[model samples]
Target: MPLLPGAEPYRHEGNEVGVLLCHGFTGSPQSMRPWGQYLAAQGLTVSVPLLPGHGTRWEDMQLTGWQDWYAEVDRKLTALTDRCERVFVCGLSMGGALALRLAAKHGEAVSGIAVVNPANKMHGIAVNALPVARHLIRTTKGVAGDIVKPGVKEVGYDRVPLHAADSLRRFLRLLDGELPQVTQPLLLMHSTVDHVVPPTDSARILGRVSSTDVREVLLEQSYHVATLDHDADRIFEESFAFFARLAPSVGKEGTATGG
Candidate 1:
């Protein structure tokens, strides 16, 4: 039988004040496992959902679109909000795009956002040149990079779906237009030497976001996947601190709240 809804091994639950972690494109919950583990240890409920067409086959990815991915995260975020007092979102790469969209559209419900190497634009001149290149670049081989774990080294889909890439481009365009709508505290962690998404993407985000409390941390030693790189610990430490500051304060009148 096919896996039931929310039956993936990645989902987990805990106390109130949930933290949702979204992994990058073609990546599974494994990419965010370390961060999720650390947060769960902190007594916060955590949910790391595998995006549609991922953690399975590359062809499956071609069959799916950005909407499918966003819908899945949306469901998890809604569930987290229903069960917790406040919700904070953290995402890596393409997942970061989804997280930003959530914050932009649901700013009233989100307490904070933590993004690692968010990809607001595709890298390389070819990506910019051929509007049809999105369909042409069908596969991206995983490299043995510093950011990937040994077992998870072969990251991303072997065959990148062109239609999906086009959909991603549309989403990025939408995010670019909606970024100023995000006014919550944001922590953007990006690697200076990232080989995938350009650092300029994060720089653009730092400049465009309307959030008054936006901070950027430069990971000098890592690559695109900062969440699993050598600087991953630092990402966790700083993110934990960011969320702590955003935690709702309890009033003397027996009410809990956050700004």
Candidate 2:
């Protein structure tokens, strides 16, 4: 699908330390561009690929599923990993799930992973309906831009695609089962008042992952799309600090020694 203007994929060349950012389901790379740029400004190589079914008309998304989405990110991440001596990943919502799965498959090859309001499991009985309802329903109200800060907006599909969401559930379940295999450092941040994905999903991930170094922070001022909300700067800075602790060389000027 052709990308909309201003919704194109973004890439910036920097040091051998690369950071791959993934946007959530139905969200275009626009949602993650700011974060990628922030990291790039810090002299880190960064890329945010528009997922297979995203950055175009909503109807176009109906033809794709989780595999297509994950493949795009996996390809970008592995490419970064192969080229860089150190690599980190960041994602929002379902993007977080993708990051976790990469950690499971790539192991310590991923230096660390940072995510905000990631969804692995949804709350309430509404989830049970996904199996049967996906066949009967085409779309539902989307969970996009669930930000508490007024006037802020997130770029995503207006309605949730049933088939794609169903595929996400299955993919998330698969990732959840493999969470124990994710031993890389993890930094998870969740909003206190998110209306889309609940806090339980974040808790569940912390409970399941075997990572020895784990940090969970509460975003008291923002909502689900905190990456674009009032606390956006905080998320970026904290994430940079998290990476700095692991890769101290990142903070110094001209740290790029080719891997």
Candidate 3:
């Protein structure tokens, strides 16, 4: 499938500490490109893969589900692991769930993790209908481009696919059960007020995960898409510092060595 312009995946070559960046559900890699470019500019290897069923059209995403989306990130993580001595994973919203899953399954293989408004569980009475809705309704309102930054746009589908959403719940259920296994250093960045995902999602993760090294930062200016909003610079700088402290080390020619 041909991708929309600026929605294509991106990769930047750098040192041995590789970072795999995942975009949110219904959101394309375009939302993460600026951040990836910023990290890449620092001579750190970076990848932002376009998840399956996204970056094209809404119907295309309806045909794909969580597993298809996850398979793509897993493949990218595998590639990064092979090339770098240490790897870190970060994601937005649903992508955050995928990052945690990677850390849980890969264990010590993943050096650490950072997430922006990670969504693992849904709230409100609307979620009670997801199972039945998936069989009846095709889609509903979308949670995209929720940035407070005026004029900034996140290329994504305007409608949320119910079938795909059901898959998301299944993936989250599996992930929530395995959260205790995630013991890597974690940094959670979230907005103070979000219209889409509530703060409880992050609280759930913080409480469930067994990671000893964990910190949370509240984003005061940004909304759900904090990566492109006003606090974006903070996200970039903080996550870079987070990665720097854990990354093995950079040798001559910017290659990574023992930390």
Candidate 4:
């Protein structure tokens, strides 16, 4: 299948410290490319994998679910751990949930994590309707391009596959239980005026996670997709600094370094 423009995954093997980035639901790597490139330029090995059923058509997304999406990042994380002494996972929106899942599952293997507008649960009637809606409808309006910056658009499907969305709901529920398992340092950034996800999502995560090293940055000028919005540079710079501070230094042997 041909990928949409700007939907291609990104990878940069720069140093011993690795960062894995995950995009939002219905969003492609395009939403995360610039952030990944920025980190890569700062000498961190970065991987932004195109999740399965994403970067294609909405119909393709119906064929996949949260498990498929999480598996892709899970596999990528393992690959990074094999090559780098320390690895950090970062994600936006649903990707944030996936990143948290990785940190929960891997524990100390993940040095730390950073998330932008991370989502944990759905709000309003849609949450209740999703169970029945997935079977009755094929797709619904997509939550994309919620940016304050003019002329900037996120690369994602115009429609949200209902089946996939229902799966995401289930995934978030599972993630809530796993939040306490995320003990690594966490850097969370959220847009104060996000149109898609509410600020409460970030607050819920902070309250649930076991991580003592937690930092929160508020984006006043951006929306949901802050990574691609007005606060893009701030997100890039701060996250890089967060990972750098947590990453371990190379030892004399260099092969087996401290993390």
Candidate 5:
């Protein structure tokens, strides 16, 4: 399938310290490209994979589910583990939940984690209705492009595929039980005024995760798509610092150096 412009996956090979970034549900890699490029510029190997059923038309997304999305990120994490001495995982929105799942499932293999405006559960009647609604509805209004910065657009489907969204809800339910398994350092940043996800979701995650080293930052100026908002540079720089502090022999510039 021909991907939308700016929605293609991205990869950079720079050092043994790797960062794997996952984009949100109904979102393309374009949402994460700048963050990945920033990390890559700092001499970190970075991978931002377009999640399955994303980066294309909404109809294509209805054919896939959360398992497909999780599998792709898991595969990329394995690839990073194979090549990098230390690997960190980060994501935005639903991608943040994927990063948490990786840390839970892989344990010590993940050096750290960082996420922006992650969603742990769907809000309101939507969550309770998706199980049945998928059979009746095809799509709904999209939850993308929630940036506060003017003229900045998130490249994503204009509609949310019902089936895929239901699968995401199920994935989060399963992940909730696994939160205690996330023991690596975690840096979670959320937009204080996010319209897509409630702030309580991040609070729930912070309370449940077992990581002793965790930091939560509130993005005062951005919205749900903080990765592409006013606080974007803050997210990129802070996440890099979080990863570097946890990894051994990280240089002053945030790249890994031989001990």
Candidate 6:
């Protein structure tokens, strides 16, 4: 299939087990590319699809709705499943929310899920007031930490569209209701000092999901963007191990080589 507009599709051909990586809100595939590279090096097929309105100007993000974001990732997930024997999903921040939605709806198809700083809820009074004061508040983007790779920047839209924030709230509500349905193995990673998302968000997901094999990795050095922060290596290693354990094996020893 041809690549979608503003979407970058990375394909590594080797093992059948695949991992679909999703980046955070207002972030691009660059944020997740490091982890993708690590997993690919381990012989797993990895796909990091750029979310709609990302990897471009922030102004372009204003025109897109959450449905557009979800649709794009859904298409990528479908494509990965078609090519791999087993597929797992991992996401950061809002991307984590998207991953949860996918695992909830497609639990039978997904092998496992790994989430980093999943934004299950909006924290603090100012952010909580966004729904009512979103019109008055014109912008959502600001200079975040300088933890990105060289030449990569993370700037969001100048204004937080009231409609888009409203859509996100609705999606969270839907996800809250659907959490009990997710029974696949789930691995959640979050930082203790994440400024954008609260640790409670991870706790909520841990409490709600029906998955019996849920595990949480608390990152001490990173903030919200754990994928690019100090604990990034740990995230890659743990996620690789998680997926590898679930991958189908070919030998009598049951050791799968990739992903």
Query: Residue 10 error for model 4, in Å?
Result: 0.5
The residue ranges of model 2 lying beyond 4 angstroms of the native Cα positions read 256-259
Worst 10 residues of 2 by lDDT: 250-259
**lDDT (0 to 1) per candidate:** 0.78, 0.87, 0.89, 0.91, 0.91, 0.77
> What are the models' TM-scores?
0.87, 0.95, 0.95, 0.95, 0.96, 0.86
Q: List the residue pairs that clash in candidate 1.
A: none
> How do the residues 85-202 of candidate 4 rate in per-residue lDDT, one tens digit apiece?
8899999999999999999999888999999999989877777899998999899998988988999999999999999999999999999999999999999999999878899999
Model 4 gets an lDDT of 0.91
- Candidate 3, residue 92: Cα displacement in angstroms equals 0.5
Task: Give the lowest summed-lDDT range of ten residues in model 3.
Answer: 250-259
Candidate 2: tens digits of C-alpha lDDT, residues 92-189: 99999999998889877899999999888755677778989989988988877787778868878888888888888889889989999989999999
> In angstroms, how far off is 212's CA in candidate 5?
0.5
Candidate 6: which stretches are off by over 4 Å? 1-9, 126-137, 143-162, 248-259
Better of 1 and 2 by lDDT: 2
TM-score, prediction 6? 0.86
Q: Which candidate is the best by TM-score?
A: 5
* Candidate 4 positional error at 224, Å: 0.5
Instruction: For candidate 5, write residues 21-136 as lDDT tens digits.
Output: 99998999999999999988878889999988888799999999889999999999999999999999999999999999999999889989999988888887677999999999
- Summed backbone clashes in each candidate are 0, 0, 0, 0, 0, 0
Across residues 53-153, which tens digit of lDDT does each residue of candidate 3 receive?
99888889889888899899999999999988889999999989999999999998899999999997876688879999888999988889888888998
lDDT per residue as tens, model 6, 143-231? 24434334434433334555566567667878888999889999999999877788999999999999999788999987777788789
